[model samples]
Target: MIKNVIVGIDPGTTTAIAILDIEGKLLYLHSKRDWKREEIIKAILSFGRPIIIATDVNPPPKSVEKLASSFGCKIFYPEISFSVLEKQELVKAFVYKAKNEHEIDALAACVKAWKRYRSFFTRVSYLLSKKDASELFEEVIKKLLKEGKENVESIVEKMTRKREEPEERVEKPKEKGEKVLEEKEKKLEQAKKELEILTRVLSKRKAELLTYKRIKLSLEELEKCRKELEELKRANNILKRFERIRMKKFEPLVELESINSLELEKLDKLLGLENRVVYCNSLSNANVLNNFGIRALVTECEEEINVANLEFPVIKIEKEFIQDVDGVKCVKEDKLESLLAEVRKSGLIKWLENYRKRKENY
Candidate 1:
């Protein structure tokens, strides 16, 4: 008699299969790379006839549906796809450890299907126990599950009654030929059991080897990432050091309340402003500024300063350009250089005009 079993399949580049007995006990679990449909069917048949086929995804895969059709079994799938966490939780209680994700997924799918019909299994078991016909359990369940239309009590009653019936036959003396055939059958059964044990051992070793290869690859990838992170951190540190050096190049501006004869004279005496950049409100004594050897003048003057005659540039600037650092007003060296470039361009034009005029006069 063919035993009824539930089969779970995870199909992909790596296909996995898990089998559970009618009692929800795990009978077999295995996975292979690029397993063909025919190979899978052959492997599943080695366990028993499948009563149900299951998967871990919703909108069941066509491959799984086809497998179920091949077995003439019912298909079971979750309404939503099972998460990684859920799959892990489902398999945690089992003593068997799944070597890879595919195996775990197949096992989880089988467990889910068993849980779904667990109540019906319990009811059938209860009915059989009351009838005192535990031997008919597998036969009755196979009928109820496969047909799904049969009354459970009726099946139990019919099976029990059949078991009670006895058949009468004429007895003949046992022949030596019959004894030899019976011995061969027993030997064949023992050989089949031994082959199954060896296959399980071989599959376990293959799983271990596959797992080791994957772990090695993962370690290599982690090392590569660590090196990249270190390089990034080193680059970031170099940038921070370069920024500190660049900040040192900026000089604090000597603030002037206003730019006039008195202020220019006072600053010249106080700081010796030969090449100092000064900030002020307005330019009053442009002539005096040219004499002091002031490098450039920054101001918030709305009206333009006539710097055509004076050698130094009188640059108009908004308040945003000035940055206060450590209680001192300073401008970034790059920002100051850009402002100076604009001033110099105008100054150069004015100088070129005057030089041409002097040459013409000569």
Candidate 2:
């Protein structure tokens, strides 16, 4: 049923269908006012099977999509919507006469698709018989659609080599030749069955091997992430010990900030921080550290802030207060990114689980 024909459809209140050969010859053309989609599909199939379904509109109407999908043909439309003048100009060379606007539009689409793939069409039609050319054209189109694309000439060349293989020549008496032909035919049928079985087996094994490779990669990533989780758990335990020590140390009440009102001589006893100064970029950073049970000499206040529902001890210091401490250095910028990354790996785990299911099904 494969044929190198282009089918153009002008779908609306009236549906028009046109079929043209690879050489731009019009084989069939018709438009019906009340025809349903099924009737239109049948008329196109009656002429010859089509390789391309053409439409004058970009993002073709649903009627056109149904026809193209039913016929298993690639849909073609101009990148930009074609103007009436452009459609008329394109159709003029293809057909000598047209009864209606639908006919003109359908023929215009057919001509455009024919011209687009004309170079490859000429080579295929010239080198092979019509039947053989039809088969090769169908295969090449399938491959082009499936694999993004392969060069048309390269596909034709490979097919040519396959068809031109040498065949053995034999001579015998007429009666003996008939008997030998029958025996050879029986052997060929048996060989065909064996080839089919082996091909199925090979295809199945290839799929299994691909699944195995994907599963192996997923397992490795999962193990690495598990080890990282184990390390984070150990780090969390260390932070808990810091909290325990802070609870046991010093007075019941401590001066919250290093304000100017506080005396410099009594600063060590007034401030809880033992010669340490910690800076807070915003209120969020304090919330993150406190959630993990870690405490530091914060240089920001917790008063009147509602960022975290569970509040903790946060103190704000004046800009000049840090000058009282010596050898102060800022923390590295990447520490926050590293901490957030460890806490937000649920998405990664979900993705790996999905990948594993897809590979297993394949």
Candidate 3:
């Protein structure tokens, strides 16, 4: 899914107002000299209400805030340094397709100025207080760039350099001026030795660099997994709390068969307002109850609570008045009671009981 974001900036003489999607896809580009803020804002809103509005202009004008507030969107103020190079790259790419030299020059100048500003900002930020990780990453990139440049230079030089091989001629032993074959052999051997040493050093360095990259990637993945695990643990704790509350509601229902008629009435009244109740005397009855909204209050017990209304299913008793069991839980009694009162007012419990009994054989 493409999430939407609208970026807006007050364009300077050389730069222009632009809007990009969340994926950094440019949607609208306009020169500041020709367009007003209202016009630009209107054009953007016409596409869709933006979830985020970004601006480099300081203390966003009241008019902009009012427009944003009307749409219930958030305004983001990203530092100006963030978008300068991005804008240049985008304009440069556009200008590359232009038909005229003037357009090309204009675009190139804009790109150059933006790049300089971006570099200055980056240098200042880096020098202010360099983060260990960021510094390491910068160092790695610089080393790689240096190595790449050196390799290209070396390849070019090799291709251009003239190579002279020894001329094949019959060896005529000269008395005084001829170099010995032993000297030539020694020179060749020395050259081979140096090449072998250089090759070995390069191979070792490459292996070490690969190992360092692997370790960095592994640490990043581990950190991501750790955060995910923490989120899961929090969710699990919430589920456990819910389970405990559910189990507690079941205890009264399980003891229903052992209690006297009066006690059963009290228990029924307590469980009814506190939770959705159900009665099941046999396995068939349990199945019938299960088909309804009720969940088992106690394992192997006939009684259950209605899952929808969180009330007990009605069991015919001598009393007509319904008692509230809101205070039965350990905590949040008031909140629970209030919720139950609201549910009762909605007539959901009565509807739930009738719906369940009619649908199921119980």
Please report the candidate that would top TM-score against the real structure.
Answer: 2
Which pairs clash inside model 1?
A: none
At residue 353, what lDDT does model 3 achieve? Answer: 79
TM-score of 3: 0.22
RMSD of each: 35.4, 34.2, 40.1
Steric clash count of candidate 3: 14
lDDT of 1 by residue, 192-236 (tens): 999999999999999999999999899999999998677667645
Off by over 4 Å in 2: 94-96, 127-134, 145-150, 157-362
> Can you rank all candidates by lDDT, best first?
1, 2, 3
Candidates, ranked, TM-score: 2, 1, 3
Best by the lDDT measure? 1
TM-score of each predicted structure versus truth:
0.40, 0.41, 0.22
Segments in model 1 whose C-alpha atoms lie over 4 Å from true places: 126-139, 146-151, 158-362
Q: Is candidate 2 or candidate 3 better by TM-score?
A: 2
**What digit string (tens of lDDT, one per residue) describes model 2 on residues 258-349?**
32323322333323334333345344434433333323334435455542343333444444433221122232224323433543454357
In candidate 1, residue 106 scores what lDDT?
Answer: 95
